[model samples]
Target: MTKKIYWAAVIYTILGLLGGLYYRELTKAKNFTGETQLAILHTHLLALGTLVFLIVLVLEKVFALSETKSFKPFFWSYHAGMVITVGGMAVHGTLTVLGKESGGAIAGIAGLGHIILTVAFVLLFAGLYARISDKQPVKAA
Candidate 1:
């Protein structure tokens, strides 16, 4: 799971860099809206894709998943959400580049995916809080 998160982070970072470079070139060509969408793409990749994935990865290591089974579901949920969210952003971003405002199948799916991603973030937060706040009886030495 840690490996998966790291790989996702690396991939997302690379894509974000590419998007940035593309935005730079577009800006040089005076393509304003293209630059704006590319900026959004960069943020989406870095924040939702890289940052959230890293947080989950560190939490997995810190929490010791081998000792806890329940966390698996939350971790999977967050990861899945990030995947779908990033995938949607990629499709929608590309479409936006083509001068399409909205009203397409991919656009609809992308919008739904963003909502799922937000829900996933909330679930992850709840799971972490629950895990940390649970009390375990202590044995006195």
Candidate 2:
């Protein structure tokens, strides 16, 4: 489980790097213009997704998070949120760059993604709280 979390963080980091390179290339080509929606996507993928996952990995050992029933749900929900949010950002950014305005649907999808992210965080916190509250002191060998 810990390995899975680490791998997920690594994947997000690689993707974030790719997004940065792509954004730099687009800027060099004068295609990026002033629309920073994709830029936000790039940063958030690294900052929120990658960084947060890494933090959770560190927390897992301290909290024994694997023992919690909510661990699986938290993991899946958070990753799904990242995918939906980043996917929305990509679509919305592409449309903006193409000079096409994002309609209500696009905005709504993105909004839903954020909502999922919020719920996922809530679940994660609850799981952590449960583990911490129930934790027992370790005995010396």
Best by lDDT: 2
Question: Residue by residue across 1-141, what tens digits does model 2's lDDT show?
Answer: 899989999999998988777667766576556865777878989998799989999988677676677778889988888888888888887777666888889878888889989998988888888877775332233
- Model 1, range 13-68, lDDT digits (tens) per residue? 88778767766665556565543345577777777777867777787677543234
In terms of lDDT, model 1 sits at: 0.63
User: Model 1: how far is 1 from its true place, Å?
Assistant: 2.5
Can you give the lDDT of residue 66 in candidate 2?
Answer: 60
TM-score of each: 0.67, 0.89
Candidate 2 TM-score over all chains jointly: 0.89
Clashing pairs in 1: none
